[model samples]
Target: MWSALDLLSDPELCAGMSIVDISGDGLETLGSKRHHVVSLYYARKRAEQMGVTVNALVISDDGGDLARYYSKKVTIGSNSFVMNIKK
Candidate 1:
């Protein structure tokens, strides 16, 4: 996310708006869930500070909980939203 943002931050780009679209299964299977959540929180903060919108497309299998989690912790900025694809 940071790398994408950094690339978009180039002065020559002159981007009027910056948005990050994230698509995932809404599962944190790598490391600590707590750490992942914290990292996402800070990433969202940074995106907000840069006036960037973060949106999510959540592929879920556990009812609507995954979408809710993403809406609460992942998506940020103006008109940001999460779209859930239930399995």
Candidate 2:
């Protein structure tokens, strides 16, 4: 998925000693923000090479509804590009 991919592509995320990726199925319920999601399928490979744990979780917005956007986050912190995949 692009979201995961974008997050991983971040230099800060790569700089992290560990990386976690989470994704969720499209909102099954209505009245939710429509989000086009992207993720990296090769996270396992990257983890193996980077010697980091490739953690993946199913994510949802508040109320467990559809999400609006896949965050493209990159910051100056040691670990970056972490999306809040919880309520």
Candidate 3:
């Protein structure tokens, strides 16, 4: 698992600068599982602690309703923040 500090701070090897926000596109399409959702919530929580952001992007072919629904269901117990990326 990658941490916010890992993304925000300098890397051990490659000379790349910053990672900015950690994003996971298509996180849970079917909204059929919460395991990965919980993982993402924890990752975002850690990122918040490190003053970083986590972009959990889930795409929906159903005009974003599926994506929005997926986010809603996953964030229920977590109360994690989520946003829609309009195309």
RMSD of each: 3.5, 10.2, 7.2
- How well is each residue in 7-50 modelled by candidate 2, as lDDT tens digits? 66677654544455545544233333645422243434454454
Best by lDDT: 1
- Candidate 2's displacement at residue 12, Å, is 8.1
What are the Cα lDDT values of the candidates?
0.80, 0.41, 0.46
Error of 3 at 53 (Å): 2.5
Q: Kindly list the per-residue Cα lDDT of model 1 for residues 10-29, writing each as its tens digit.
A: 88787766999988895544
TM-score per candidate, chains pooled: 0.79, 0.29, 0.40
- Candidate 3, residue 43: how far the Cα is off, in Å: 0.4
Ranking by lDDT: 1, 3, 2
**Which model, 1 or 2, shows the larger lDDT?**
1
TM-score of 1: 0.79
Model 3 / residue 34 / CA error / Å: 13
